[model samples]
Target: MTDYDVIIVGAGGAGLAAASAASENGASVLIVEAAARAGGSTALSGGVFYAAGTSLQREAGIEGDAPDAVFQYYMTLNQYKLEASLVRKLCDDSPAAFEWLRSIGVEFRAEDLYMSGVDKVRRGHRAAGGGAAIAEALEGSFAGRSVDVALETRVETLLIEEGRICGVIVDGQPVRSSATIITTGGFGANPAMLAQLYPDAAIHGDQHWYIGAPTCRGDGILMAQAAGGQISAANRGLLLLTPGFAKELESYVPGWLMMVNREGRRFVDESIEYSVMAAVLGEQEDRIAFGIFDEASRMASKTTSYRPAPNWTADRLDEFVAAGTLEKADSIAGLAERIGISPDVLHTTVNRYNDHVSDKADGGFFKPASFLRPITSPPFYAARICAAIICWTGTGLRIDTRAQVLDAADRPIPGLYAAGETTGGMFGECYASGGASIGNAIIFGLTAGREAAALARLHAPLAATS
Candidate 1:
């Protein structure tokens, strides 16, 4: 006997959304998660939704910003790499998705915020409680609903019948279903998968670290591949600049700090987005960079992005200094010597930068005058900044706009669907924004669930006869 009409794998944002949609469509649903809890990397996120045409948008008093504009913005960012149909689905349906979440107990505020890669619209709607709140709302949505969820149940393999995905095997037991959906998230926690998929990142040896949920080990991707689903851009991920040892620093690097490669020279505008920063760091020697700042810069600047590190009090900065993560020196030469770079080159770099700051101009990188603070204060600092994985893996099975898992030939494998990070082709070489990732997860997760449930209903008679 079939276990359910729809069997959704992984209980993250995508899986929960899928399960809820399936249940609403009159299909019996069961969500099997490998982790002990429902929230995957979604719980670790900022819980912002990139949506257009929302009531919040109207309330914010921004006029003439339509969904089409949002769609155009993403198209420009992705450079037509992502499927236009899927992108349209996300952009057009996002407002309804945001409202649906509200209908399901998810709370969001109408705050106009501009995120990285989003140039025109301020559509980032922040969840009232961040990622955890969104996760809690989705998890709570399943209560009293016609859905069964299994936590800590590792799906070992897909149960294929004559090349069609019918269900999954977990702990040597098979639970047959009319339709199966994969929402297992990305592979940030799996070092082996990381080395295999992103070998370039592996070149860092011991320096690379992932800052996502440990449960995100790419189980759905592996199972999808084993079941003959085609993989898309498995090598790409959302990488951030950080002082590797301290995971908390992943959010915001002070703009006043100059980021230098191993050769001891600034490579990019210190005020650039994290995705652009990561790409620049990848080209540097050893894939490593350092955030160079002085006492004045530190005292004057506040954390601009990541909330956890926005206000670095003296005590917190001192703690990092005492821990040696943030190196200190009385002179530019001393700072260079501490970080093992050429003192003369470091001095020249500082001198040139100080000259630019004095002129209120960034000749090379064009950083705005507001962020160009001179690094002349005594006791300069250079903190090692490396790329940290933020769990938005640019990888996994190929899916069409309907969220059907496609084979090598781009043909949909019947009864199989995918959503969230497990389904690739949305993100390419760069992460658009935090809101984009989470919003796509919810939109596609809902699509996959409804489509899979419809498929289950269409095949129920055939399944019963068989």
Candidate 2:
């Protein structure tokens, strides 16, 4: 058995952050990852960290914001589904988190425009090249450190003794440690698990594309549950929309297109924020939605303001059309007929939209004119887009503010610590603005590591005194 001060399962953002913090505090740390890589979902993310009143904003000559204002924006948008305490913590600690990242050589640049359709004050921050940049910076900080990163190693279960977590079992062997941090992400990639957690969402085939790594199989959650930790709000997960056909690769390809539902009607103003779009996408049956566009829409995408996915391009769109993966028609009616929808319904939908544009009224749909580009152009295009569930489910082992996994009775499971998605329901019912996941993971991981290290230190002294 290999002994260490701390053992962290899952080498994603949270685990890596925990390892760094523990090592910095003079504690030996081991990070065991199932995949060969360390980045995990953070590498696959958009790398935007939303923080109001950040030091970066102040340095850039932008006016600082109040925490109350930040809290108000999130609460208003999320409709108070989120826990007040956790939301308040996020707003309060985000600035410090941003400063911490910068201290570790991570740099961020402000976005030129707010993400269309989400209501918020300007506070979007992105690392260069998105997530990879942040991951690289984190990797740099661990060079030649006492932190041990073991890749391609799967943690089978938690090793508990006398009601306290002693370590973990990995690959049929026991790795002993004084403390363990479970950062293994959500169960979005596991079809069986998704079916169990959300039966109604599984009906539509290929509705969600697992944008995160396939290794996020909920190992930590399973282990923690077996050890008497409680899980809360297992049904809440973030829903995202990707371009049609990209589901085959299980990747997101965002572009300038209009989204519609089964009734051939637009449900949201595409120009609005992404969270609003995500919420709208979640409401549809099987979380499946469609993207309708035309040749003009494709052309306009050349300079489209928001491009979240790299794989989305005009060439790819043309290829999808040629391969019969995407449908194209000379008219909206023809396009609707090909996609197995009512032509009259689509036609009337388009006419009403056009009338809205002419009359300067929202026409009951409340779609913003910015996204209301008439779908009347020639060579109409349509693709079946659905909610691409990036497997960061919000359910996991319940933990307190200190990131200690608690039992069903709300008592801390001794020596058992959890961070990231494994410490579920940290964000409560609503996922706040960007970087909330990564932020929580890092902050809680640090807390767990330091707290565990202190406990381990106390054990030897107590034994000596005895």
Candidate 3:
């Protein structure tokens, strides 16, 4: 059995950040990761941090906004669905979190990316090389430290002593520690959990691909529950429906088109908030929509401004169409016929949208005209954009401002702490602007490490156990 001051699970952005901080604070730390690589979903992310009114913003000549305003924005957007305490902490600590990353040698460029769907102020900080670069920087900081990283190791269960979490069981061996942090990411990739939590969505055969790591299997949630922690309301978890073919899998393949409903009618405006599209898709009985576009729309997708990924191109679109994965037609009526919808209904919907776009008014659907390009060009194209889900669960553990995990009774689980996606109840119900996950992970991970080290120094020698 290996003994340490602290044992951190999931070596993603949060775990790495915690290890670095704890080691700097003079505590022996052990980081165990299931994957061979260090970075979890953070490495696969776009590397944007959604922080407001930070020194980075001021340095970049951006204005300093109030944390209260950020909190209010969150409340308004989420319709007061999130917990007030957690939301307040996220907003209050966000600026400091941004600065902490900079102090650790992770550089942030001044360019700000905006999510127009949220329609809020632009406050996203992009890291160089995206998520991978941030991970590399953190990994570099851990060189030659007392912090030991064990990769390809899975933590099987929490070792409890007298009703308190004392350590964890890894690979069938008991590794003891004063504390354990559960930063195991979200349960978006867990199909079983998804089926249980979202029965309505499961019936439609909805699936998810983007927004979470494949290893995020609700391990932390399950372990905590088994150890007597209670689960929160499972009412949250959003869907990501992209324009593609096949039920719930079209987002993976190529198809540049607009999204529509089962009536072969274009419903919500395509170019708006992803949350809105997700909400709309979740309500649909079919849970499968069509992406109606033309050759010109496909060609436009190749431009840097519109292209989300390099692989999304007209060539890929043609290949999918040739493969019978996409339905191509010379007219809207023809496209509707192929998709087994009434051509008159599809035609009327498109005609109404064209008039709205031409008149610069979205009377039927309030989506901005900037996102409302007429779908009149030919040869018309349509693909099934399956409703995919990306659920966020098992976030910031019930720790204090210092990021330590709290026990079932709301007391600190000594020496143990968590950060990032593993820290449950941090973001509450609303996922604020982009970068909330990474930013919170970095901030709280550092806090947990520093606090745990300080606490370890003051504590008496560990009690002997079998």
Candidate 4:
């Protein structure tokens, strides 16, 4: 006889979500997490939930946002390289997923709804207390549910019989079950996976680093691959730009800081979302850009909230310059020469930027007036920036709209399901939105749980398996 009806590998947002849905569907659940903690990368995230038609949107007076609109925007932004049916399922179930997380004690404030991507829609719902709160809520759910959590216990392998998954090999022992859901997170921490899956970010060597949980070692993806599941295309995760001024996570560059490409020309609005900024920067020469700002801007900068500008504060700037991390010069031309750009083009770019400073309008990029600042003060500074920060790897096992793991032939592997970062094909080229990953985790985790539960109900619990 089987020990449980459904076995969930990893205890991240997706795994916990799967267990939640499976238990509600009358399946006995077992959650195995490799780390001492339960949340995985979800707990370390910003806790934003990217969703449309959410109750928070209406409460915040944001209208004209629906699942279909979200679907179109996502498909358009990614250039339609994603799996349409799966994307549709994610879009349609996002609102319900939002409500479900709320029902489980996670908080999403209406006022916290903000624009999190290239789209103007305010669909990013920032949960109170960030990802830690959402992770806590999901883990706390174990108190009332029929879930057995095995911490610091990694799944050795997916146990298969008759070409179907039956359970798992945990700690060299067999744990029999009717169905298994793989929710293990990404592989940003693994150097082999980084070089193999994400070459762009891997080129930076030691300069590159991951922002997710250290336990995100791609355990679930590897197991699925060994079980004959397919791996999606590589280089698909969100990569953030950084100046290498210490590994401190800097998501947004200060609006006051101007960026110039190799030709010493401005390319982006400088204040756009990180995903868009990274994508745009990736197209730049050598996928590199430089942040230009004056001494005054750095001195006047404060630690910002809506967008973090901690690295630009006067003290931090001075520290960086002293450490040779930031190049300093008494004039703009001198700064351009140091950064290896044409001084003439840099002069023209600065002249036009200064001309509009009084009007508080960026006529070229149309940057918001509130963030505009003239780089007129003496002693200009520049820092090298590249989109090298690996947020969460996008290469993983392939799954369908129903969260069922698919083999090389795109056929579903019975009793095998996957969700969250463990499953690939959710993201296309760029990360669609801020909360897209978390939303994917919760929505597909819920789906995988229910699907595995149904599959388990039909089976006699892996009866008499050799």
User: How does each model score on TM-score?
Assistant: 0.92, 0.88, 0.87, 0.97
lDDT of 1 at 309: 55
**Clashing residue pairs found in predicted model 3:** 183-422, 245-250, 395-423, 395-424, 396-423, 396-424, 397-423, 397-424
Error of 3 at 256 (Å): 8.7
Sort every candidate by lDDT, greatest first. 4, 1, 2, 3
Note the Cα lDDT for every prediction shown: 0.81, 0.71, 0.69, 0.89
Using TM-score as the measure, what is the rank order of every candidate, best first? 4, 1, 2, 3
Off by over 4 Å in 4: 461-466
Which whole-number lDDT from 0 to 100 does residue 196 have in model 1? 87
Q: Weakest 10 consecutive residues, lDDT, candidate 3?
A: 247-256
Worst 10 residues of 1 by lDDT: 302-311
lDDT tens digits, residue span 26-112, model 2: 777888999989988888876766777777676666785756787787777667766566667767777787778888888775543
Relative to the true structure, candidate 3 reaches a TM of 0.87
lDDT of 1 by residue, 1-466 (tens): 6879999999889988898888888999989988888888888887888887887778878777777987777677767777778778888999899989999888766553555353646777888888888989888876787798899888999999998899999899899999999999988778788788866556666766666677788889999998899998656767777675455535557676777887888888887766456766777887788888888876765544444454354466767888877899999888999999999888888889999999999997898788798888888988887776454677778899999999999999988999998877777666666588888889999999999999998888887887
lDDT of 4: 0.89
> On residues 190-255, what C-alpha lDDT tens digit does candidate 3 reach at each position?
677656644433544533454667787777766766776544445454455654433232212232
Report how far off residue 87 is in candidate 3 (Å).
Answer: 1.6
Pairs with backbone N, CA or C atoms under 3 Å apart (clashes), candidate 1: none
